[model samples]
Target chain A: MDLLLILFETGFWAATVRMATPLLFGTLGELICERAGVLNLGIEGIMAAGCMAGWTWVYFGGDLWTGVLFAAFVGACFGLLHAIFTVHLGLSQHVTGLGITMLGAALSSFVFRMLLPNITTPPKIIPFAPVKIPVLSDIPVVGEILFRQSPMTMLALVAVVAVAYVLKKTPAGLALCMTGENPSAVESQGLSVFAIRTTAVVIGSAFMAVGGAFLTLSAFDAFYIGMVNGRGWICIALVVFASWNPGKALVGTLIFAAFDALQMRVQQQTAVALPYQFYLMMPYIFSIVALIVMSRRSAYPKALLVPFRKGER
Target chain B: MRLEPRAHTSMAMTILVPVGAAALALMSCSVLILWAGASPFLALTLLVKGSLGSVFALSETLTRTIPLIFTGLAAAVAFRAKLWNIGAEGQFYLGACAATWLGTGAIDLPPPLLIPLLFAAGAIAGGLWLLGPTLLKTRLAVDEVVTTLLLNFVVLLFVNWLVFGPWKDPMAMGWPQAEPVVDAALLPPLVAKTRLHGGLLIAVFAAVLFWVVMKYTTWGYEIRAVGNNQAGATFAGIPIDRVVIRTALLSGGIAGCAGVSELLGVKGYLTLDLSPGFGYSGIVVAMLAGLHPLGVLLSALFIAALSIGADSMSRALNISNYIADIATAISLLAVLAGMMLTRYRIRFR
Candidate 1:
């Protein structure tokens, strides 16, 4: 009865959907990059940059929606930097990505310190409020779980459908997949591998940033250092579990978020007097388990981590 | 413009490229300095003065480089084998835990016996920490990057649990930390008045040893072969799995040594903030060294001075000490370009 009471609660499912929003963005972003045969290790830092960019925009008196766009733009700039090295110069994607992560996180931290030298606590902004859908909100439990949410969550759902549709149906999607699977084949088709891959990385990085922005702009009031807190890394694991499909990514993210939400509930409700750190470690431990469980069955991009030179055989 | 293959990079280019990249990094930092309302020129002088102005400053910088050398070698060794051990931070913490567990009243012994025992225990613990991920990668086709990175959060939480729950120092009025290591376990001071310790000798020795092993040994040759092309290395009769597992042990062990080096030499106990991202910084150091063992020595020193210099610069300017991190990140990015230039030349039509 107790378990049923907790499971049937609408608030828990709402929290699950709320937590899934950022991860959906991140998993989709990573799915885009990996589909184009690039492993963006920079997702963690790009999200951090997004968190800062969106919050800083709002903190400096910009409106919420523009803050989201600005975060995407900033994410794109870092993407350009990543693309220049990994796509253009053909450096090791691992090192380049880790460097980008450091740069993004450090730059945001530096800018934050400069902007607010004297404040002890992080400055708060008017975060995105949950907006109710008229007809849908009146419906039963599913309506509360899905319809009554932040606009960013709706945008994330739209992105998932859009990404899934584009990847499955569009001409551009075919080119992107070819660029990942076999760049030489794509090149022979008279399309520039460089162009397609760069676009995917840049666009993918933007989604990652939006995922980050959702945290500060919608999920929480202000940015704190390390607040991204390995969500980016977990999203990478989720993408693996999703097997590179946007729809599956949405499903995987929701499931993971449910577990995360459930853990928080259990930690709060349990009277066993457990240390909170163990509960905090669960997400990471779950991701490692997820990777092992799902890694074998997934079909990876063929040219992943391989640099495609212009004319080398 | 396009990149064209260079038949061979000249001797001058090899030396000039990294130097130019480092200078480019410095020039970019000047912009940040200007943004912080300080003159870049004076800041540069102060950075130099702060990092190398006196014997004390030099010792502090050297003391900082000690752990970097171990972690740098850790990353360099694993990266050479294409192991992708991003969990050096986690391994470093676990290593510190081992030192804490054994060195803190588990068994009391003289300095000569206790110090080596602690270092050995730390290395084994660190190696075992990575062994699990490496096994998962080798056996199950799982990607180690994600697992290793995620483990950092896991290990940090574990450390939090230990310090706050079981290992709490009751003497310190509830500030969560483990008990200090016995005095016999303490590293002999390298300089009387400074924080510098004899662990610098161990680190330098480790670097020299790594240089020899990486450059000359047949095992080293196998590591390079596997990293260059795993398919080729497998075809050439290399046991891919064994080499990876072996490299994991060595790499993780080195990173673990860094933790012990910090615990025994500097802090003398385990705490939450034992490292200010030394494990992550090791990746920066290794890449900047181009994953060369001897190069790790100089690059570690450079990174050490840069951060220490920034700390000093922050005192004079209104800027935060994070400027050094920005500068280091820029230099690493620049190094990527410099790395490419060494292998190719740009052509415009």
Candidate 2:
């Protein structure tokens, strides 16, 4: 009975919130970008840039919110760079995204080394305190799991709803969808496809940056090299798994997060003595399997990877 | 916008285009240096000297080039078939794992047999690793690019798990690494004292073999046809799906060889961060090489030189080694833009 209690309290559900935070931020950001028809493969780089930028800013006496904003700004900058290459210069999105990622990785490492010169210890920061809801504080497990969390969690939920509203309900959202689906048709209807896409990419990148910042400011307080790890790529996969829906993205992110959390929680008790590498492989393995299965049933945007050209369908 | 049949001028222009693009790339790097308050000329000179002037630096550059060559060939092969296999890094790690596992206890043959068997194991492991993504892509119309990239993370985590868990060096204090391979398993030195090893030969041999197969084989011809125009190839009765799978598997296999080389030749043991983005760098090399085997060879060397030089420049100038990366990005952009110019003349409206 005690062991069962430990399993219940320490299993997947208990670890979901912590694991889900980064994925939530990343997937939501990627969802927005993909819906806008700009597949930003540079999400990994953007996230890394955000991680370093957020960590650096927060470490140097800056407010956590300020660090988040700075990370978003950095992501926006990368988005702009991506936009210039893909939209303006008409470069291949894959190549441009890879280049941006390389640049981001190099820049992150360089800046981290330059700013945080030779410290034996990883720098620590006071992370965001989990906020308990006044009315729900007394409630059992559900309330504690749902309500007692950092502001970022609530913000992620709000962002998802807002994104769903913007993509499905608003006129601008309609135009954005039209641009992604058929830019020439949208243009014929007097909409600016380039403007829509550029804005989407920038805003989408900002979300990714914020997500990266959350990883640093809320999840771990310090940044390590490759700290964003594969979260950025995971976000990209989530976009596909969600079938380009923000709400679906949330579900996918949560599921993935739960798995990750379970892996962490069960590390001590699992008698299989499987290498931690096997555990680390779980999320990625799940993601690929999820993508393969989902792609069979999911409906991707019609013009997902196609670059739009003016006066050409 | 149709080109006139001016064959001679076009040929001459094609020959000179890369040179012009290189010049433009240099200018861009110089501008970046100026932004950093450094002299471009001095930086360029130092970069050149740092990469090639010293024997140690030259060997290091070659060492870096070894894995890149395999990854570049891997990307080039897959891209030629329009397969979009983006998990070469993951495949490389898998290959290394297989090689390590085999070298550890599975094989106890002589040096020649053991080494070749290890390479074969690495290749098979890499090929198997990509099988699922290829199947998903061909059978279900799923994008291999996304799946492959995701698998990379999974492979990386697997490496981490190994280093931190079962494979953790029993003798080491706390470092996440496996026990060093037996002396007989280590790659023989190429130049006796220098860091250079026989891995460079393997990379070159792979490139040559790929070039021959791509140029001569009927399968290669079909792959190129499908990549160029799937509908046309299908109409012409080419087995498009089969070709795609074959190319993807071959690419994965080649990338796997890179893992073996790195493990046996350079690193000698697996670690979490074994690759300093060699898989990613392969994308740049493949692109810069225009997906040609010969081009991949040259581009890999140039990239290796730049990476080596970047480190040296850092030591000499106290500037960040990342300047080399910035240089690579600018060069890639310039070269890509130059290729575009060769195909289409841009006209402002």
Candidate 3:
């Protein structure tokens, strides 16, 4: 009973928000890519690259925001590479994404070693402080958990709203959806399917990069080798779990985040005899269950993973 | 630009595309070398020398090639069936865990029987690890890519739990590793002086067996038909679901052999870092080999040499060993790009 009370505390919610912030960013990004009929498996390496890029920029005396911009820029370039392979060259999406992942990971580690060689202790930067909203901070539980959070958390929420609006209400969104569902239809309608997909992939990757930047620049002070770990992969699973709906993605990400937050707290607050790895495995297990439950009859984009050439079947 | 499909691809084109792709990858990677302030010529030389220059280097390269062969074949078999078994890493760990369990248990069996039993245990465990994803893919219409990738993390944790919790070595001070297997369980060295083990022979035998199965068997024909066109295969009376399950079982089983080879042939104990992305690297090998069983052997050896060479180049040139990874990724992308270009000739509008 005491543990249940601790689990519902404002601090626990705050941790949940922190854990969910990166996933939200990555989930939103991958959602856009998948909705546009391209499964960007490069998210793992792109997120890792962005995390390292953001940290390196900040370490070189750039502001946190500028560091984030650099990460987005790096991510966009990688997205372009993915677009060239999957769209222009008509290669296998699975292999292309995996190759991009391998490339991004190798480049990030290589650049990091060259820049920071042989440091016994890893260098740290000042992470983002929680910014309390003026009136919102006055609310009891919600204010403490939601208002008193990193700037990235607020931006992520705004991104969800923005993505939902753009995908639902805009002409570009309709065109993007059409491109994913049937490229021939979109091409017949005189919109360049390739161009729309390229734009979606680039913008989506930028969002993913920001999620990664949040980890290094706001959530944590320094970048570690496995910092991005499988979070990017989790985002991929989240796309299927959420059925590619931006609003549902927000809810799904938080559920996964709550699991993560609970595990972190349980490891700290109780003398539970369970292996710590079990805690680490919880979110993945939950996501897998979510996928199994949600993937069937999910109505994925029709042309997903199909390469579109002008008149080819 | 417009691309025109060629009715027939020539024999020369088949050999030339991969070589040209490799050369292009090397040329592109040289830019990174230049950025790192190293001579590309010297780095290339050191890479070749380190990988193939001496008998010891050659032996080490072949030793590394052993696990890769099993994994490469694993990917090759699955990719040919278009099943996309990407959980080789996790399956490898499960195989290693099973081998460790059987080898360390107090059975006191004879060497010949013990070794084959360990191999079977490894293969069975790997196949079982993939069973969940296979069922989901076959029955629920779930995407295997996410499920398989997720299983890798789950099994990795399971392996970690085994080593850190129940299987922690009693003698090691603080390392998270399993106890060493009995001597009778270890694979005997094939060469007298070198580290080469009987595992190489098994890998080669498996490769030949895989080639024969893929080439001559009716099951292989069904697998190819399903891969080329699923609906067509079903219309032609092929049991698509059964083929998928059997292929996954074989794929996972082959990957599991890689784990057993590593344990009984090389490490003799389970550790967290046993596989350095062999499962993932196997994908690259299978793709490079065009998913051919025989070709996987050559590609695996080539990749193994590149990795071994990269280690030496890193030490000699004071560059990060990840340069090899960059080169490898470029090679994969280049190969895909080459294959695309080779299939159709581009013409200006």
Query: Highest TM-score among the candidates is held by which one?
Result: 1
| Candidate 2 stretches greater than 4 Å from native | A1-15, A136-142, A271-273, B1-40, B104-114, B163-176, B179-186
> What does DockQ come to for candidate 2?
0.52
Task: Write model 1 residue lDDT over B181-297, tens digit each, in one string.
Answer: 999999999989999999999999999998888889988999999999999999999999999999999999999999999999999989999999999999988888889888899
Candidate 2, B124-213: lDDT as tens digits: 999988988899888987778788998888888878878888888888789999776666677888976787889899889989988988
lDDT of 3 at B111: 91
Better of 2 and 3 by TM-score: 3
Per-prediction DockQ comes to 0.88, 0.52, 0.83
Give lDDT: candidate 3, residue A15.
88
**In candidate 3 chain A, what residue range of length 10 has the lowest lDDT sum?**
A1-10
Q: At residue B151, give the lDDT of candidate 3.
A: 84
Model 3 regions more than 4 Å off: none
In candidate 1, which residue pairs get closer than 3 Å at backbone N, Cα or C atoms, i.e. clash?
none
The model with the greater TM-score, 1 or 3, is 1
Q: List the residue pairs that clash in candidate 2.
A: A277-B161
TM-score, second chain, candidate 3: 0.97
What lDDT does candidate 3 reach at residue A40?
94
